[model samples]
Target: MADPILSVRDLVTYFRPEEGVVRAVDGASFDLYPGGTLGIVGESGCGKSVTARSILRIVDRPGEVESGEILLRRDDGGIVDLAKIDPRRREMRAIRGGDIGYVFQEPMSSLSAFYTIGNQLMEAVRLHRAVTTKEARQRAVELLQLVGIPRPEQRVDAYSFELSGGLRQRVMIALALAAEPRILIADEPTTALDVTTQAQILDLIRRIQDERRLAVILITHDMGVIAEMADTVAVMYLGKVVESGPVDAIFHAPRHPYTQALLRSIPSVLAEPRSRLATIAGSIPHPYARPEGCPFHPRCARSIAGVCDRTVPVVTKLDERHEVRCVLYGRPAEAAE
Candidate 1:
């Protein structure tokens, strides 16, 4: 197997509002191999988006990558710690869109209404590649066509608001690929689109990922999308990844209580038509007032009385490809002691 193109270790990102510090991404770790898809699944406010932003050194104001190493393997065989680099530096700017492209969750807000789609896409091309305006425009049209946007010639000149939700999404994808980056981080790529459009967007991403052989980090709450597009899975809670492994292992043999609960909550085709879907109890705790030890313990059914609430659990390996962070999987000797 090829080595990971990107490796994140013990990533801790925090947002300091006036009230208090919010641990947006607390000690989350994962790796993305070249040309492989890594799915980060969790409910809203679980740091799925923050993790992606941290990697690109684009955490908004007040949010900082406090401690961690975002090791990115460069094309020259050297590795750079993105977290330590100055975000304003030209090198970091190049890496953000040149080495790794990001498709924001919402295309409406992300795309400027003032600029035409061609102008936006061409800007990316001109920024990343040494090309004239005419060349860039041609490249932008090709990208739009590649993403399945109808009438690439005319649509490129249209404003984002002029296109439908699905077409806008396709343009966003085209913009992300304008730089031809080796990695793509898509945060909730299909949020408000219809079911058919959502499937089409997912399929488009998968197709592009294959054609480009790009390493992809797909962040979303939809397990169905993860199951369909991801080879590896990372289940996050609050701000940490509680369980991670191959998609099959995660779906069939989930070890963590939180992971089990999330899988159970997914509506199944085999279930009775009107049956109420299983749901994880309780909402995600407030950012400033996160739970004490294990973030998921409050809602975890198998949480130990004294153990889970007080003692934070470190990640334990269940196998070469599977790891879980939960007291329920503690070593037998450690439990006995």
Candidate 2:
């Protein structure tokens, strides 16, 4: 395997409000290698988006990355901890768009309504590359074409509202790629699109990854998307990864109760017609009132009585590359000792 382009270690992002501290992302960790896709899947508010924002140092006001390291391998063969950098510094700003590009979920809100798509793209290009306006405009057109927008010359001058939802998404992707980033963090890239458009967008992302050999961190709640795009999978719940392994391992042999329930919830084509999909019991606990010990224990069917409720289960290695944070996998080994 190639060296990891980005590595997140024991990340802890928190929001401190009048109510109390909300641990949005607690001890999340993962690695993204060159040309590889790492899928982060979980329910909403499970810290998937927070994890991505933390990497770019864009965890909005009132929320901050409280601990851990976000290491990015530079072109000069040196590694820098992004978490330690001052977010207001020019270097950090350069790193945001130059090294790591972000494709947000909503294009309409993310793209400026006042500016033409061409202008937005050119602004991003000029920010990272010292280019004349004419050159930036040319580059912007090229990007628009690259992302499969039709008649780039005409569409480039159109405002965000002028394009359809699918087109807007493609423009957002082009904007993110304008700087030629090493990593692309796409949060729910196919959120609101129809099935046909979703497939097209996913195909486009796959093609781009193959062509550019870019490392991608794709954050989504869709398991089907994960199976289609991810080489490795990380299943998050209550801000922590309950399972991590190869995509096949996760889909075929999920270990964590949360992971199992998630897979079960995905409707299968072979299932009895008109059958309802299985659902995991209980809602995600409120951040301020998080359950003690294992966060998923309250809803976990395989949870041990005294052991799971009283003590936090450490990550247990299931295989060479597979791991699960559950007592069901950990208790037997301890009992044998």
What TM-score number comes out for model 2? 0.97
Q: For model 1, how does the per-residue alpha-carbon lDDT over 233-253 read when each residue is reduced to its tens digit?
A: 999988899999999999999
lDDT of 2 by residue, 99-131 (tens): 998999997688889999999999999999999
Give Cα distance to truth, residue 220, candidate 2, Å: 0.4
How do all models score by TM-score? 0.97, 0.97
- State the weakest 10-residue window (summed lDDT) of model 2: 328-337
* lDDT at position 70, candidate 2: 97
